[model samples]
Target: MESFSGPDATTSDDGPPPPSPRARSAEARRDAILTAAATAFVEHGYGATSVDDIAERLGVSKPTLYYHVGGKQELLGASFTLALDAYSDAVEDEAVSGVTGRERLHQVVQKYVEITTTVHGRCLHRVPDVELTPEVRDRLRAVKRKVDARIRDLLREGVRDGSLRSADIRMSTFAISGAMNSIAQWYAPSGKLSPEEIAERLWDSFAEGLRPR
Candidate 1:
C-alpha cells in the first residue's frame, strides 16, 4: 500500500496553507477593479463614468471588467452598498458597546460621520443618480429603512430614559438622519475638523438645544 501522506501532509508547523493561485488572482482583480471604479467615480460623476473607463484604469479589457462587475450600474450599486455596509457596521458595533442610550447615539453618529468622510462616502452620494433595477432599488430602500429604524430606536431609547427631550419620534428620526446624510456633501479629509470633532459638535448642538443653556 503506497503511503498517501507524503511531505504534503507533513506538519512542519510553518503556517496556514497559502491561498490558491486562482483565489489570490481573483481577489487581486476584484480589488483593482473596485479601486479603479472608486477613483473614476470620484473624478467623474456616475453618469459620466463608463465601464471602459474602469477597464482602462485597471489595464484590463471591457470583458474583464464585466466578468468582475455586470456593468456600470451594477458597479455603482455595489460601491454604494460597500460604503453603507461600512457605516452600518460601525454604528452597529458602537451601539453594541455603548454604556448608555446617549452614549450609544453619540458613538453611532460619530462613526457615521467618519465613514461619510471616506472614499466610500463619494460612492454613497452617487447612489441616488444610479439607475438601479427594481430589485436593486428595493435592496437600497431596505438598507435606508434599516438605518432609519436604527436612528428611531436610538431616539426612542433617549426619550424613554429621559436623556433626550420628548419629540415626535418619526420627525426626529428623519431630522437626525437628514443631518447625518448631508455629511457626504461637505465633508473632506483636509477639512478643518476631524470626524470626532464634528461628531462632538453635532452632539453638543443636538443635545444642548443650541441655546444659551
Candidate 2:
C-alpha cells in the first residue's frame, strides 16, 4: 500500500495553531466601537445620540458598528453594565475585609469616585433610567437593588461598632449615592483636584459627619 504524498506535503502531529491576529484585531475593534459610542452618548445626551452618530465618530458604517455591538441600544447597555460591574466588584471585595465599617465605607465611596470620572461611569451616573429600554432598565434596577442592600449592611455594621453615629440605612444610601452621582456633574479634567484628591475630600466630608460623638 502507498500513502499519497505531494511534493510540498509533510505529515505533522501539531494540533490547531493559536488564535490568529485577526481574531484579536476584531476584539479590539469592538472595544473601540463601544468606547466611541460612550463618548458620543456623553457629548450629546443619550436621547439625542444615534447609531449613525456613533458610526460617524468611528469613521465606520452603521452596519459595521452593528456587527460589533448589535446597535446603539446594546452599546448603551454595555456601558452601564461595565460601570455597574466595576462598582459591584469593589463592593464585594470590601464586604469581606476585616476593616472597620467606617474604613469599608471609605473604600466603597472611593471606588465610586474613581469610576465616576470615566466616560461609562459618567453615563451611568448622569443618564436617567427612563432613557434605557424596558429590558435593560429592569436588569439595572435589580443590580442596583443588590448593591444598595450591601451598602445598608455596611452602614449597620459601622453603627454597631460605634465607628459611626446612628442613622437610617436607607437615608444613608441615598445621601452617599447622591454625592457620588454628582461627581460627573462638576468634575473636569482641567479642575484643580485629581480624582484621588476629590475622592479623599468627599469621603472626609461624609466621615466627619458620621463620626461618633
Candidate 3:
C-alpha cells in the first residue's frame, strides 16, 4: 500500500487550535446556512436566488444570515468549496489507507457518487460558473484539478500493483469524474435507486473495465 499526499488547503501556526463550544455551534449554523443556500440555488438557479431568499428560507434575518455565511456570492462560493473539499477528503479518508490501489479507487468512486447526489453536490455541478467572480471560479478550478490529479494517481498505483489494467490515465479520470458530476444533475431522492445503490452500480461498471486482464 502506498500513501498519497497532495496539496494542503489549510495552514497551521504552531499547531491547529481546538474548537470552542461556541465556535463549534457557529460552524454548525454556518453549515445549515450553506445547505439552505445551495438548495435555493438548485431550485431557483444561482442567478435567480438572492441572499434575501436564502434568509427567508431559513427564517433568519438578513443580518444573521450575513453573520453566518456572508452575502449571496459568498454563500455560493462557500457552498461549492464545501462540495469540492468533500471530494478531496473522500480520497484522503483513513479507512482507505493500507488498502490496495483498486480498493482505494473503489471507495473514492463510491463516496464521490454519494456526495454528488446531495444538495450541496448538486449545486457544485449544476450552478453556472458565470455566476461566480473570475477569482472564485479560478480557485474552484484549482481545487477540482487537484482532485482529478489525485484520481489519476490512484489509477497509476493500481496499474503498478497489477490490480488494474493499463489505460490512458487522463481520459479515464475524465470519464469517471464526468460520470459522477452528471449524477448531480439527474439524481432524485424519490427515484428507485438510492445513492448507495447508484454508487454500487456505477463502481461495478467501472470496475469491470479496470480489472486486470
Task: State which candidate has the highest TM-score.
Answer: 2
For candidate 1, report its TM-score.
0.78
Error of 1 at 109 (Å): 0.7
Per-model TM-score, in order, reads: 0.78, 0.84, 0.83
Model 2 lDDT per residue over 1-213, tens place: 112335334444785444445656787788898788888877788889999888888898998987777877789888888887876777785344656788787777887789889888888776787878887788778767777777787788899998887567789888888888899977876889999999999988888888899
Question: Could you give the C-alpha RMSD of every candidate to the true structure, in order shown?
Answer: 6.0, 7.4, 7.9
Once superposed on the true structure, which residue ranges of model 3 sit more than 4 Å away at CA? Answer: 1-21, 93-95
What lDDT score is found at residue 127 in candidate 1? 48
Residue pairs in collision within model 1: none
Off by over 4 Å in 2: 1-20, 93-98
Candidate 2 overall lDDT versus native: 0.80
Task: State the lDDT of candidate 3 residue by residue for 47-116, as single tens digits.
Answer: 8888888989989999998777788988998998888778767776563564677988888888889888
lDDT of 1: 0.71
